[model samples]
Target: MIEACQVNRSTFFQCLNGKRLPKESFFEHLLRTLQLSPGEESKLRKLYHIAQIGESVYQNRQCAKKCLETLAALSGNLIPQIYRLDGVAQLTANWASLEGDNRVFQELCHLVQAEMFLPEPKIDLFVPQEDSRFIEYLKVLYRNSGEKNVRLRQLVQFPQGRGKKTRESMEFFDSILFFLASDCMGYEAHYYYSEVDFADTVGVLYPYSVITSTGVLLMNEAMDRALFSAAPAILETCRTQFEDVLCKTKQFHTPFKGYQQTVDFTLENWEGTTMGYQYFATPCFSAYLTRELVDKYCPAGMEERFDHYFQSIMAGVFYVSFCSEAGLMDFARNGLMNEFPERLVPPLELEDRKTVLETMLYRPPENSRLYLMDPEKTTVSDEFVFSLAKGKRIMTYRKRLPKLRMFCFQEQNLMDAFEDFFESLPESSYVLPRSEVERVLRQAIRCCEEQMTFDLSNQIG
Candidate 1:
């Protein structure tokens, strides 16, 4: 082949042995002489570029790792190709274009089917729940593969309130259950209802490989590009983020029979479990607890029914009391006071209220110790009194809750900083013993009752 290409055998051998690098011109000429196909030639060119980068960065560990990642990605059997289109109308056209490029579709199908053949296969997805077509595609893929063992982990946005788009969001949740019920696929879905919305990127992680895209490929809202990689570092990073989000979000279970039926199921199975409950004054929190309390306690008897109803009504009031004078009072007054006066008549901050709520909710086992860090005068409510009477643990700080600049568990420095901030709080901030809590709560409630006169008959009515 070298002779035919008019190249010296020694020079050709040197290039082949990696002792020398070949110019693009020489590489093209070599491909031509070997009569390589267009696809093979494209792969070779990509490989060459990767090789050049690898050689330049060989001495720098970090740079070398990156180079190696690029090389591995280019060399993989499934390299994602970018398809540019004008708008949503072009999605069908672009998909038709992909029909001619069976390699991409086939690779995706192979990954989906891997769950059936490979032992303990896992797939992770980071995506927007509003994309129904993507969910449909997954359903079709799972149905076609007939694989029952594939474990799917997804990170999806669950909007915080029943706003204009709430119906659409609820439909998406229903669709998830529909997909799950269609097959015996082992799957877990995490709902991220945070203040920060992640970039519209979809990532899929398999046991041996990873594939990521700019947006839902089945939809036409965002970029139509993807990246496929077998690089360990890249895969690990994707896996880590998927896991971090999983750790920070709530696990959503399938509502098989119906929404109300599922509620009944949860109450039956989860009643009396010591849950570390965190309350924040959000429509989502109010809606969720109302259903939970009603479902769990209303079914027991008339007395239990009234208790749960009263707790549900007071939950919001309790949250407002905690927020008052901590900087959230104005927000509560302006946004929620009128509509929820029965609940928010007591009125509320620190940093953004959402951030405080998310931080409090996401910080697990530690959340069992309720943090009452409102730097203002201690305000107690019926709910607070009831919680203390029920022996719930509490923690208090003289200072308000600190704003977390960053909350990435993977970054050791950030984790260390978080720990330092938490540990630095004065030990005196810890709440007194349970007996003290009962005493304080009782006195506060008595004071409140005396200050706010009410007809005793009205409560019975």
Candidate 2:
């Protein structure tokens, strides 16, 4: 390979190790560098494009295998247009509505530094920032995102909601044979009391947002700080609230199976002092409203008490995540829905708002808190998420129409322009097994984006 490249073996090996990206002009050398088969050059070029697009979307070992399969699909041709974006869906609509106060949005704007990268960069739309602190901002923001596609400032005003469309063409000749792409966009069951929360589908409609009930408090700092360790105490103070609901209903179902019959134990400190842990089911708002009573007004030794149990309770949330690399989604099959293969996000056109509503697909029982149709009996479907009725065309509720169309048009144009312009919309996607984790990430990202923006704006002021 080295001799074919006209470089010594050492230099050739260096490029292979990622120590160096071979100069663009040298791409042709690859034909001989690896002693490729006939017509391999074009295929290798297309693969590079795929890798570049995917680098932003996936970051695990499984992603690597998916990439290889994509390369194999091309069969040795550098056909850029050899791919197709025809079926690709724009998932970034309303995602671009950069709410003025979103921190993640500000962080991305600050981190990208268009002024530094582009000639005669317009500083007008840019936030005045402390360049020194901006890098740190990216690190912390990325950490909280758990390697998922939580766009910056997107929470305050999502591009789709804000009338922006996904403007990219993530075309590849053929999608790989793997389903890893669908890992994002679903809820995790472990977080809720169990999948039974909506009969198992509570998350499908209200999602963790159900917890954002009026009385739930929002304490921003406690979460932003590496305060993960501090939450257990808060949970200890709030455990009874969860238990009380179960006790009241006379069916305290735990996500952990077979424990329904386990004798309930009143939470007590090491000294055996019984304390009430009831706060609110929706802890984000609960934390906000109860901040003074919790973060500030810990009952005497309560802060010193229940610390251990608090940790255990938080763990029960069972947090895991997957992110979108570009602003679009690709699903040869539905990974989130265990019963069917479908694209969770629907594709939108230039001026079309394709409101995406993920139905747990199965109706829950009347007494079901969440939409859980015994997994033993229920199944996922092949129904496309955006096109719930692409073929079947069932009537969605009247209320779903306004926001539904609203969600569609906002993303349609943006989706059109982005895919056309950027060649792809890399989705930083996420799938949460625990509603709490899903809830917290959504709220915190919103808050963090808002906080950073407000803080930066203040500094500029």
Candidate 3:
């Protein structure tokens, strides 16, 4: 093949042996000399390019590991309190007279604020990639969005390739905080995957944009030039383009209105064999709840439905649940569950709760595993519980009130982050090892049993 390709034998051998990368000409010549079919040639060319760029599965794995670590660290701090910009001074801008891109961007930020002040305000954004300049824009949108009746819809690239993920393209995790920060504040994202380079496909025409009913700001890729338009024709054209692009996309983030919708979504995507992970303040009660327990404790009309949901959640599945020590003690003492309303379901009896802990220790389901999370070692929140099922979805349930809510994240790239996050937790310093967890469970069981005896003695006295 080297002879047919008119390449030096030693150089060709070096390339084959991984000592040196194949040159573009040499790679193409070798493909021609081999008389390979179109598919074979394409695959080889891709492999050659990947080798030249030093992209490997190992690098992607390492990148993914780092991203997961960052995510775990940022988990507790993801939600930012909504800021009111009431007294903030608005920047005055003559759009046509704007000289620099930075000035235009500032003006655009002001425009976004103006839109937010309107009743029923909605902002449409097209972000081709994780451009640094737009971070400020996103910040503005999320900060005040908490209190205002504002809506944010974003169109973002999936940040991947046609085949395996590339290290350079794995920026989804970097922008995940933005997606999660505004989750409760009327935020939605639609995503699309391009067979070609994602940035190259959309970046040329619409690198970054913020569109509202009244105005539009289009920023160049360099972040140094922008076009601001309030003309009806220009605004309509941008709106049409956004809708056209949105039509080719799929919804990336989903918000569950209530328990029924959350349960329905879970059952519809159920995977029996997948090992799952949960991060909650206490053990996942759904996995441990028996039919009788559900019938006894579940709300009046929700018995059969809750029972079915609980059974479906646990059936033929393995799970590793991370619980806080304080939460376990509370469960052992008060029988309180984060998921169910105490008024409706009521706390379990001391003996019943003891039995549940004992079952977890001795006769636990074959698929169940528990780990204790050290509060001092991790930043995970008690208000949020994350349920991750492989190849299914990651459900985040917020137990705090005004109202309870669930957010479902099912995008593949985001799922990969959660999967890595979960897998890394078993080895994380925040989560206790199996032996430590077993010791704690025994302690909790003994505490429950002693509490039961004390109450019985008091009644006798």
Tell me, by lDDT, which candidate is best: 3
Native-structure RMSD, model 1:
24.4
lDDT of 2 by residue, 1-461 (tens): 56666766776787788686666545567666666766686678756655554543322223322332342332222223211112211122212212222343342333233222332221111111122233234323233333343222101111222211111111210121111112111111111112122224433331111011111111121112111111334434333453343343311111111111110121111112221111011111111111222333233454543344343323222211112211111110111221111121122221111111111112211211211111232221111111111111111010111111100111232223322221111121112234533343344334434545676899999
For candidate 3, write residues 1-461 as lDDT tens digits: 77876789899899889898877788778887889999988788767755754555435545644543444544343544433433322233323434465565566667777787787787898754646555555565665555666677887765356334343334554455445534345777787765555345654744678898778888765555667777778888988998898898888767877656654555444455367777777777667766677677877776666666666667766777878777788889888776543244588988788778888877778778888876665544466666777887777655544445667777766666556656766765667777876787788888988998998999999
Model 1 lDDT per residue over 27-56, tens place: 878888878888988788767865865632
lDDT of 3 at 177: 44
- lDDT (C-alpha, whole model) for all candidates: 0.37, 0.25, 0.66
Worst 10 residues of 3 by lDDT: 85-94
- Measured against the true structure, the TM-scores of the candidates, in listed sequence, are 0.30, 0.19, 0.73
**TM-score, structure 2 vs. true:** 0.19
Model 1 scores worst on lDDT over the 10 consecutive residues at 399-408
Poorly placed runs, candidate 1 (over 4 Å): 1-110, 114-116, 144-147, 195-223, 254-461
Please give the lDDT score for candidate 1.
0.37
